[model samples]
Target: MTRILLIGAPIAVAVSVWFGGDGEPQRPKDDPSLRISRTAAAPDPLKAGTPEQQRELEERIDALPPGLADPAKKEIAARLVASAENSTLDWRSQYGVIEDIGDGNGYTAGIIGFCSGTNDMLQLVEHFTERHPGNPLARYLPALREVDGSDSHEGLGAPFEAAWAKAAQDPAFREAQDLMRDRIYFDPAVRLAKMDGLSTLGQFIYYDAMVLHGPGLGPQGFYGIREAAMAAADTAAEGGDEKAFLGAFLDAGRHVISRQKTEQTRDSSRIDTAQRVFLRQGNMDLQTPLEWRVYGETFRIDS
Candidate 1:
């Protein structure tokens, strides 16, 4: 019986190996291509410092030198502010400045510049809003869409009317009434009629409205300037003036997009970052962290 059981076990083992065996499948054993080593290891728990130690570290950082702060930092910030405030400039020119200032700066410096610039722009906008309370263009011009039509009187008239109407009721309206009246001389219809010859001052005023209010204001302040430019280009094209319409079209399109892009980019990169960090951390100035770095660098405060 023992012999028979041993013989049966061998047969079972052979069948299992051929089908589903308990043992893992064996493959050709080649020399190991790589080797690894294990070293003695133990967990090193993270060290916890006392509250007093943290306070001491903070105090030491507060003693650093201010010269450690980057000079280009402030310059970048000032330029960002200036660009937003001066959005009346041609888009190409404004974009160039943005591109120059934004290139190759640390995130913190960029944040500083962007926040400063946006703050300046907001201040300027507030001033305009206060000064021209009723002017829709002054208040809401930034929200207009880009101008697109000939005889398009859509964006240009309403802001002026709103401003004038509000000013008329205010006691101080008489003081700057004449200037305001003069500024609003062209109603939307009139402005559309003379779109071709719109003065540079007109363009500036229109752009200023857009910048202060928002870019979406479209052509409310500018009237038919876009259309006339397009018209001139068409005429120039028909007259075989290759340089005329094509140049005008490209130039106008480029200027509009470039300026908007730059302003938006600057706003996003600088203003948005600064505001988030500043508001999140409370109203701390850029100088605080800067001072901390000075102490750490000179006296090894962190060390």
Candidate 2:
């Protein structure tokens, strides 16, 4: 959503197994902190796409109270988001770059699809460079900066493409991917939700929109939507009803989603519709077996 990541991929949702541990559904074996002998869930090699099982996996994590009692357990939210955003639950799947997609960047990259024009992409490149100084992608910093707002492939050539390919193969680069998302979407949304007395669903709604519209006060940006929602109804943060605020917030989100020209696939529409349906059903906690449609493709996770 951040940039035009959904250029032209397969339309049908793949529904793979969702990631866990840190904002993931299950801890990885490679993590040093966990002892290696428990009967935890095995890693599903093929899981992490637009699969029915992804929804089923998310429905199982009812760890938080209504208003996101714990942001640490962000697995379900991120997991469910995979189906809507990337059609893949693995956060790692979203780290590649695409050039010249008319998206203000010849090098838009990362999970939330940070575009070169947006400073977020600068931060992403900077962070990656800092962690892995000698990384192949480091040399292209200047070219990346130069091409920030232009779709022109100008100075970037095989080196740039190879660097991105190399970065994808490194473990440290993968860490940077999650860090960027946290800095841009997850962390801010959770923090704001806590401030606004919003539940996990509200947190998710904010996070999801931020990923799409970028996090500012422009006409269709995340802040603008929230501002519009605030005008329509008072948030619990302002000593008003939480449900009313959430409903208003949702309406605002749908407005933004409707206008995004890059949403060629309309997968984002389901993100809004699903929340609207849940809120309509008074499922403020965003309890599962959720159902909705994106571009006329209906999805029901009632089981």
Candidate 3:
């Protein structure tokens, strides 16, 4: 799957309501058009260090408090991500959000923005079909697979978009999206950040990068960026200052963002005006009453 937005909260419970209008799923007129970056991959394995070093890192992480995983903080993360991804705080309203947005990724849809051009959208539909056979979007599996890795809508067009919208009306489908999102993005990002001995803010930084760059091992993917950052500075688990490591990570993320030619991917405001602002304030715990801008739009999560 390509660059998509996964609202960084446990959504299984939150998505159990109707998100469509009059039996149809429509994007709110006022919601700005969605613009996403690009690809999703399988979760990266713990291969950053030697077995002994990895074991030590695991132990160190096991001793830290639950940071981003905490329910309250997770809500904040969701809104923060929504501000950049959907341009609104009503993340639940995005259960049915779908469009190509002409970023060369086919049919970015659902709360996670699963792209038909990427592998994740196929997996999501497949997973949903497994749970509920003959679902509305099931017939398009072949087309999804055929179009994977590129922005070709070959066999899927209006029929496929309608099918996706129809499927979005199902709470089961919504729950499936949530489940796949956690499995593919959220859970792994948080787990890796914890292993890195990152605090709440650091964990969030990793998650945003993961959503934007995917979990691949490529030079621009989340793991590669982490590797590049670690090369510049040690992780907190490696006995380095948390702030320094996070700064290095943001620098690495900015570099990756800048290299992408797409207008969406090239924008680093998600890091520059959002996450980096928190870092500058030393809000390592990500305390509330937060304010930041992404894509030149300001958002806040006060509690």
Candidate 4:
């Protein structure tokens, strides 16, 4: 049986009430001055061209030296499109596209488009899943690679475990679980999306939970990417490479802190109220410390 941590309902309600106010709590607007402040930080490099242009671009990309066709580029393209479409379209239309594409093919296209930073493909996948409650392809592709007991990387495992746990608990997620358990998949872009989604939902609690769960799956889960990045940052810092350090820290911040904020904000009203009161009183006591911690932990960085 899964050991679910059941937070008390009354405490949860109290926290929500304390945070809620007259109108919805306004999130802090992104700082226009900071380049990375906005989620939509930049435009997609792979714009949808006329079919001719797209074909030409894909041919060029495919023809590149193997080393030149980095997966990150494709993933970024997909993300840019996803972010844009999320803003404009209703969910149902998105679902239709995914259904039309069918399994394997739609997912494969999405993976390529996303990795290439193609906005259209990314948006299609995001909207499709949002509209289709049980998107088997979306859910399974990430986990399918793991079944072989090979390619056991840490970053890959964390998302799989979280998804598995969530699917097991929720009946609606059963199809996702089934697909994941029995599919052949390969696409780093999809894996990244799954990780991003899990982080967004606050279900990737392994970071903190690992500290308590002993050095097993959760700790091992973040071990691959987190340790590699941290080591790289340390090496760069030692060599006085400020640029490398900054980039490394930014990546670390994304992996470690991004999910925590999403978890706390699951009940936005309470978090907002707590933040306001804590700021006004300028006190950091137990009653109000969580809010302050969230703010500092999320936004502020020590140089």
Candidate that scores best on TM-score: 3
Selected candidate, larger TM-score, 1 vs 2: 2
The digit string of per-residue lDDT tens for model 4 on 1-303 reads 010111110100000000012222112133222111112121121231244533433343233332201344322222322222222112222222211111111121111111101122223324445656575335644433232222223233345444433433444343332232112111222221122221111111222221111111121222233333435543221232433433353344344333442352122221233223333453312121222223223321121
Q: lDDT by residue for model 3 over 216-261, one digit each (tens)?
A: 6666777767777777776665567889989999998899778776
How does candidate 2 score on lDDT?
Answer: 0.58
In angstroms, how far off is 84's CA in candidate 3?
1.1
Candidates in descending TM-score order? 3, 2, 4, 1
> In model 1, where do residues sit more than 4 Å from their true spots?
1-192, 195-232, 235-254, 260-262, 265-303
Count of backbone clashes, every candidate in sequence: 22, 20, 8, 15
Put down candidate 2 lDDT per residue, 1-303, tens digits, no spaces.
443322211112122113343333332334433211112221221333335543443443333243543543366566556656555556557677545444344555566666666666667778989877998878778876777655656567766767776787888887887777776666656555644556667777777776766665444666566667767776664456877888888777777666655655234565556667766777666666667665555665543
TM-score of 2: 0.69
- What is the per-residue lDDT of model 1 for residues 134-244, given as tens digits with 9 covering 90 to 100? 543354344222221121224434453344345344444333432222222212211211122222222222232222222221331121223334444432212223234
Q: Alpha carbon lDDT of residue 113, candidate 2?
A: 65
What ranges in model 4 sit over 4 Å off? 1-47, 68-256, 259-303
Residue pairs clashing, model 3: 1-39, 1-40, 1-119, 1-120, 2-38, 2-39, 3-38, 3-39
Q: What C-alpha lDDT does candidate 3 achieve relative to the native structure?
A: 0.72
